[model samples]
Target: MIAALGLAELKLLLRNRTAATLAVLMPLAAGLYFALGVGGEDDSWTMVVTLQLLFSFGFTVYVTVTTALTARRQDLYLKRLRTGAASDVVVLTGILLPVVVLGLAQALVLLGVSMAAGAPLPTRPDLLVLALIGGAAISCAAGVCTSGLTGTAELAQITTAPFFFAMIIGGLMGMSGGEDAWVFLIPGGGLGTLTGAAWGGPTDHVLEALASVVAWTAVATALSTRFFRWDPRT
Candidate 1:
């Protein structure tokens, strides 16, 4: 039952214009955007943008947009599935796993290509792993939470704008903070620290960074668990 639902979800996503574009084009575009945004710096700034890409996509695009899109269009199908052989947990996992798996796979592929093309390997592998897991989980939960608020598929684009802007600002500030007072308030600062640690952060810094992602995850997940709607708004 889980396998069947996963297959169906995959097919449905493949047929959507937005999902197809996001899955195929968003990563490369993000790489280019980050590269350009940071101006090919030799310092830790560039690393900041790279990890920002991972967090930004996981939260801004994947969690928020895709979840809302699926809920708006397929809520009926999803609600019905919950009543069948598949458990609610299985049904949600099937719908959500494809993008999460694809994102992780793509991140690995990008890491390999970046290394081949001269990027250095991560120094704090544990920190990097935490960011990947914590950040992605939060984003996924946030998406489910937001989907409960959305009214239609088309509205998703407009609804997701705030997160997109937040991510862009976060990425930019993350790359340019020079002990600026306002930097710590920016979520991207924590993300930058994590990315920097991935290049070998001090133990203290890595712990702090891990804490930030975990805090974010907790907040998003708590909200999602409380408010997420399983049925269509109509």
Candidate 2:
């Protein structure tokens, strides 16, 4: 049943040109621009890869998830799913599976492009993988939380802007080295730290970055649990 729903969702996602473009083309274009145009020194590569990951998570995973949920709710599809036997978790996971898979695929492709463009292999692949997983989780959970506040699919663009900016800012802070401990509290801070560490930039703050990513994921999941709406807003 979950597989069927995921398949259906994938079809719908492909049919919607706007969502399709955002989920696929936009991130690819942004990532490729850096991968192809940026210099390959370690510091420069760290910044480039950080931006590429951020672009993929922010637009491909985060925005697409919010927009998909909002559209489904507005169309009464979410409500209809709730009437079925599937648990809410199953329903949401199914709806989101395709988006998450596509996001991971894009991330990998972006990394490959970076390497092919002269970027050296990551010095710490484990931390890189950790960063990718944590970042995706943050984006996905944040999307669920944001979808609750979105009145319609159209409103998702406006409603998601604040966190989107927060994630971008956090990523930048992480790449440049946060002057204080507080930056880790931001959404993409952990991602930046982990990505930088993966590229041999620094490891003094790995624990803090780990905590920040996990903490943000927990907070977003809690918010979604408490506030996510299954019905369309009148």
Candidate 3:
């Protein structure tokens, strides 16, 4: 029953033009644009993971966060789910599973494309997996935490500004071949560390990045549990 609802939500998301386009297609588009824009440099495994992280974070975190909040507000989707056999945890988990699966699939696709294009496979596949899993989880949880502050779905874009900016700025840092001390605190920066570990030697800073992710996830979970609303704020 819960699985059905989760699959239903995935279908609904696919049907929505803005949500589907951004969530599914936007990353591919960005990857193409970057691939072309950079003229397919002999980028490192770090670059490969960074590109995948770009997709997962931008689509799953930025786009999906607003979409979830708006779906709740406009369609009363959250409210309806709560009235069903689904418990709150079940509903949240189910709704998120689609995004999680999509993120994993997209990352794998990107990884395959990168390798087929002559890029080396990640020297450490485990680290790549860490980046994908940790980044996706953090993005989804952040979305839920962000949803509580959202008033409407249309405005989901606006409320998503801070996190999106943080992720982007952090990505930019990775591209510059250097990292900042504070970026270690950004959600995406954890991904950067994971990517760096995959493509190059360990930074000895791995624990800091993982710790940052754990802290953010803990806080987001606490906030979501306290403030997530089934009904529209009105």
Task: Give all candidates' CA lDDT scores.
Answer: 0.59, 0.90, 0.70
Model 2 clashing residue pairs (backbone): none
Q: State which candidate has the highest lDDT.
A: 2
Q: How many clashes does each candidate structure show, in the order listed?
A: 1, 0, 1
Least accurate 10 contiguous residues by lDDT in model 1: 175-184
> Which whole-number lDDT from 0 to 100 does residue 144 have in model 1?
68
In model 3, the Cα lDDT at residue 37 comes to 52
- Positional deviation of 60 in candidate 2, in angstroms? 0.9
Candidate 3 structure quality by residue, lDDT tens digits, 1-234: 668867987888888888888788888777655544542665544564586676766675556865766676567877787888878888777887887788778767766666666666667778767777777777787788777778777777887778876776665554333356687667677677767677764657677777766876787778877866777777
**Largest TM-score belongs to which candidate?**
2
Model 1: per-residue lDDT, tens digit, 7-51? Answer: 777787778767666665667566544445543445643463455
Worst 10 residues of 3 by lDDT: 171-180
For each candidate in turn, the TM-score is: 0.81, 0.97, 0.89
With a 3 Å backbone cut-off (N, CA, C), the pairs that clash in candidate 3 are 70-153
Q: Which residue segments of model 3 deviate by more than 4 Å?
A: 43-45, 174-180
